[model samples]
Target: MSYQALYRAWRPQKFDDLVGQELVTKTLKNALMTKQTSHAYLFTGPRGTGKTSAAKIFSKAINCHFQKDGEPCNECDTCTSITAGRQNDVIEIDAASNNGVEEIRDIRDKVKYAPTECDYKIYIIDEVHMLSTGAFNALLKTLEEPPENVVFILATTEPHKIPATIISRTQRFDFRRIQPDTILQRMQYIVSQKQLKCEPAALKLIAKAAEGGMRDALSILDQVISFGNDEVTLDNALMVTGSVQNDELLQYLEQVTQKDTAKALEILHQILNDGKDAARFIEDLISFCRDLLLYQQMPEKVENDELNVVNDDFRNFSQKIKPEEIYQMIDLLNEQQENMRFTSHASIYLEVLTVKLATRQTTISPKTPQAAGEKLDPKDTIKVENLTRQVKQLQQQVEQLLQNQSNGQSVTATNSSRPKTTSYNKTQVRKTTAPAKVDLQQVYGVLSDATRTSLNELREIWDDLLNMLTVAQRAVMHVSSPVAASPDGVIVTFQFDFLCQRAQTDQPLKDTLENGLDRLIGHVPRLIFMPQEQWPQIRQEYLNGQKAQKHLTAGEDGQRTEQETPGDPKQPAPKDPVVDTALKLFGNEVVDIKND
Candidate 1:
């Protein structure tokens, strides 16, 4: 074979050689030394975090002829073959490629045969999450209880995709992303062992860029070395990684958070012109903001470069910017990042994002919590004010009448002591029989801007809404069906007129219904009820009224675009139907309704 890649050549061959997985190594070594190993094991984590390497080492350690205290003697024939991937017993399978039921069945059938080259037959399946659902089902029985002396080791980056049944049957070991410092030390050792000249800053950059994956760090390092003709430098590392200098990223952030839009956009233009990825720049900015926020809160955590974003400039910038401002910038950046994913012109998004962040207001004054958080509809406000004013006027009139009676003490009071009936000509009182009529204003209010989606949203919560009420309240609601809904109100047609009248008059039912709906959907509705038989006529009348209103608007404007669009904008939406009704009722009607 040709020369192996750095990641391949530096693959951990022994449990002790594994980096940054002390707990995993310790447990595996204990199990092997005590001759107590699981029939199946799962190794899962981010890519290049020593999952497959750990699995391979475990396989060799378990089957090595010269195994000593769970350590594989690489000199032994069995261990050497496994290391070379030529061992018959240590079977490595790429589940991503051969993930089928038949392939798994073949393995199941072959497991019965004895090991030819080693004491135990070990199966290592890499990227095992790619196995089909049927393939996972096929391997379940064999995985849970394979033939004696057979072991299965499954490795994957995405453990969430794996079936719980598969994970439950195996002893799971979670591999963490290798820390940057740990990777830095490992890279330093690799460079020294190879006797190559490399910059400390370059190694640190590669380590941070690896993002907790040692294999990724090494691969980046390999590319940087190749680019620098076997000599690593910071410039080569930066070119390979496409990361802006720390000072430059810091400067860009400072300009943005300080509300310097032009300067920030200029910096972004230059950075993008240098071939830096827009998406990558977004991610880098988000990460930088994260570090800045963290450093601002915990300045002591910067020891040993623990945060991996520390420099004199970063620290000073962190001091200059408020943590909460960083929070807003990060939020804006993240939103733009999601938007960037759907578009090819990422530079446009980046520019827009820069301007938004730069101009974003940082000093947000906290809102004083209101006793009632929501504002009333304009119609509701007018009704309340009119009612209040009328009440004050009535109180003053009543006081005047009382004062006049007290001062006069007239003969009417003396005459009221005797019981008397006044017989006036043409004075007759008789009760008239009339059924309760559907309130047109109420139905029209709900159907004003009603939509199918709003009706569906109301109906979807009907059962839950009923469940929230008392037995009597539920009984009143059970006879009701939501026929139409706008954002602020719903028209519920009742099975009976009595129930409809009861729903309107019952104060308790009103509160629970509206309040429960508000709790469920975060908005209260002006619930209207009418007998079910009257709903069709009312809906037809409302639609006709809408058409008439549209016709009137067209006559006044000399244009009708209803054919082009099914519904014309001439029919103003019920921004707040209750408010409009109040305004109309209170003798103050605007000829044109502003679409606010």
Candidate 2:
């Protein structure tokens, strides 16, 4: 006989021999015993979860002549022949290769024939979703109305791709992934049966690496056994799986918690140098943080033996770190993971993430009143006293100014000379009058030359621009709208005055918006923020000024036309003398014509 892999050699031949599918096995066994088995069945779940094994076991058990209480007697000729794949009545098809309509039609044509040597003719189609639409349509009729003594078993990992009509006609059984503990127990039994010595932790590690797949667990165990001589140890298992030891991961986490950036980065470099995958390392770190958070919240709920770290060390570390810090760390790591997916320089990202984790500040707990008498740091105390004296001096200056206002006199220091006093008053007067007037001429000029075509283009992609921002930035700008656009800048008006102020003061938000816009569009125009309440008034005033100048020019042109053609009797109406006189004295165009 040729050498066989562990998964193939240890394939389950009976329903009772299969592990971690009790619900499916028990239900099928009862159905067989009652002689109420359906003609067609659908088994769906994750890979290596005993779907195919259960299908084969059920096929043999239903046809065995010496079957008792839904259990197959493997000693019988029928059972043995079926188990050895020599039976003509039982067939296994890989749909991934034979998923054409002609193949399905061939099966449909063969279903009419009676079984050659068994009670029923069984067909097991794995990966049934790979069948084409036409093939599915061809099989639909046969599945809905199958010949007697004929059984169809369809298995797939993705049931959603299968047609609803096909699923409705068959009895469906959903298989679940095997638990780690269950996988471990099965491995221990296999080791004992094969007369192999293995450490319990070694089996547990293999089980964890298998990720709820029994076939994967067995394959890993088989490789580990081949690598070691007699006994399988935890270190050997870790080596075969290319996984880091728990101690190494724990030390790295310790450096991060202690805020030691240099050591944390060194550990990260070493892990990568040892050929560990950067993405996988991040995944394991996230799982470790989750475990710590769980253990911190409920110690009794955590299985200490299953944990990768020593229980004592885990407990001590949990005490040193708070729950909120762990949450923030997880969030930051997840964000970094998302960012790393789009970049080729994953090592650089991982290094940067390590430093960020190490440098993040831990939140301080509030101290109670009883602990207030503890000695404070001298530097902090000195800074606090200096700030207090400056605050007092400012308060005194404010009070003196208020007193001088009540007495109707300017505030002047008694010790200051007359020249210094005059200089102070003049400076204060200039500060008061600085912002009372604004020259709108420059703004009007910019608006007149603004390109509406560019503004329209921006309006079309405004939503896309907002979508590119982070969630926090989006929330801050949600109430704002782009009201006016210019070639050099865009004027965004906010519904609330405070929101406008916030948008103006937030430099980082402005930079992010600019960068995002530059990526979407070719250029990043300047953003001008104003409150919505003020926008209409400013726009209306500018438009009215423009209209008045047009009307004045029109009046002058009409007068000239009348003088040029004197034969026409029509003449222009006279303007108000007072308005004309005011316009002449001020040397400005008349903005309004009033009636007396």
Please tell me which predicted candidate would have the highest TM-score against the true structure.
1
Instruction: Give a tens-digit lDDT track for model 1, residues 1-596.
Output: 79778998888888877999999999999999998999999999999889988888888888876788788988888878888889888889999999998999899999999999788999999999999866876787789889888999999989988866688889999999888889999999999999999889889888888999988998998898889999999988878888777777888988887789999999999998887777778777887787777777786776456437576777777777776787788889889988988898988998898889887877765663365486768998899898998788666655654565556532222234333333222112111323356678867776666666777788898999899787878887887888778888888888777778787788657756765675578767787777897878876676667656766777799775344433666874434343443333222433454433
Listed in order, each prediction's TM-score against the native is 0.62, 0.60
Per-residue alpha-carbon lDDT of candidate 2 for residues 70-145, written as tens digits (9 for 90 to 100): 9899888889998888999999999999999899999999999999999999999999999986687678768888
Kindly state the number of residue pairs that clash in model 1: 1
Candidate 2 has a TM-score of: 0.60
Least accurate stretch of 10 residues (summed lDDT) in model 1?
424-433
RMSD (Å) of each candidate, 1 decimal: 21.5, 17.8
Clash numbers, per candidate: 1, 0
